[model samples]
Target chain A: MTANARPILETERYRLRILTPADATPRYLGWLNDPQVTRYLESRHRPNGLDDIRAYITSHDGHAGFLLGIFTKTGEHVGNYSMRIDLPNAVGTLGVMIGDRDHWGRDVVLETRAAMLHYAFETLRLHKVCGACLSTNLPAIYNYRRQGWAHEGIRREQAIGDGGSRVDVVMFGMLARDWRQRREMEQEK
Target chain B: MSAAKEVLAQAFDVSITEVPDDAGMETFTPWDSLGHLKVIAAIEEKIGRDLNTEEVLAVIDLASIEKLIAGVHRV
Candidate 1:
């Protein structure tokens, strides 16, 4: 796909679309600055400014990896979903951030994840998708578990967390066949 | 308080009496993201049903929770 060619994925209450340099606003930067929001993310380890965000956004353009902005249906940009596609291996790695605390606990993560997974497996024809999270991020781990992702493994002392403490990184993976089966089961229910 | 409000109060570790009718993330002090997840889990347990994506996102406040629960039970 071209740099500007992005698929828009929609859930019941939100939309996911390609992120552009224009989205590197102060509000988006504030999400990075919020220690509470980025506590489990590597971004928290380093200070970030608008220039860094703009460069990050620019770097993804026309790349194998994709970054999409998460927006409410009413046009509120709340967070982001990034996927790194490895075409040769037919695999993708997923990452997500829900910056808007107000939208938390509302299953927005699951909704956006479902949409992205659909794109990965159905549209991109990827065989598997993987994700990783800090072990302390219970909500993210729970979200992955509920969505039928397998607990691949854990890397001990993989990264430093908030307060400079070493933390394990939990890895998760899901195959396209398994994801399709789960969707079928949900539909049957 | 309604059953949903009771669930919310319990999840937030507040008294049922303390749960305002319009309590939400914006209005409730303890309604943080983690607290919101607990509230949803409690409500799901109380109702004996898993909330779908739309129902989950629809719950924003006491009124919305009550309404969504009523709709679920109505079905």
Candidate 2:
């Protein structure tokens, strides 16, 4: 979708919009460079800079996949959430980061993921959505579970974490049917 | 504990009485990287201003956060 045509997803506190090259500011780069922020993330494995951010925006700007910037209702650029689509499989791999340290522990990811999942199953008519994260990342694992993603399996020793420690990658997936059922169950509460 | 310290205690899910005056990531088991962010966000809400990068980094402990909040109110 074109930038202007991109759909904006909203939650009670956050607005998810398309990320553009204009967001590659020093502050954005700062999050990439902060080891504390990027730890347990694949981005930490690469050398990230403005060029990388710009290149990312250019490549994914109008594709089936969406790279969204997560902003507060007041428009603070706090972080990003992305979904990469595999059309043949009707599945999307999800990723997210709350770069603004001040926005952590606020359930922003949960809200954004819910909005993205709604678009995935309801709007795009996708069959499944999956995510993978370092197993050591307890908060992410908890959030995904709370959102009804089933624990698929572990990719044993799949990645290196801080200080070169090998870590298992946990995989989680949710089918559209399961999502619908979970929503119904929640509403009945 | 001060109000900012109380906020930190809530973010970390500890009792206000249990939160020490110098509670921080290094000293408190619950104040991990994510917990640190939560504390900062809560402090910002309490103080009514967004903290700069430098101030955020400087606020490594309860005393430091109180100091930063004090500085913001002083201006």
Off by over 4 Å in 1: A1-4, B1-75
List DockQ for all candidates. Answer: 0.10, 0.05
Cα RMSDs, all models: 9.9, 12.5
The pairs that clash in candidate 1 are none
The residue-level lDDT of candidate 1 at B68 comes to 66
**DockQ score of candidate 2?**
0.05
How would you class the docking of model 1? incorrect
Worst 10 residues of 2 chain A by lDDT: A1-10
lDDT of 1 by residue, B11-38 (tens): 8778898888878755777765466578
TM-score of chain A of 2: 0.95
TM-score of chain A of each: 0.95, 0.95
lDDT of 1 by residue, A1-189 (tens): 222358899899899999988999999999999988898887887879999998887766445788899999899999998888787888889899898878877878878899999988888888999999987676776577557788887787889877887877888999999999999988998
* Best model per TM-score: 1
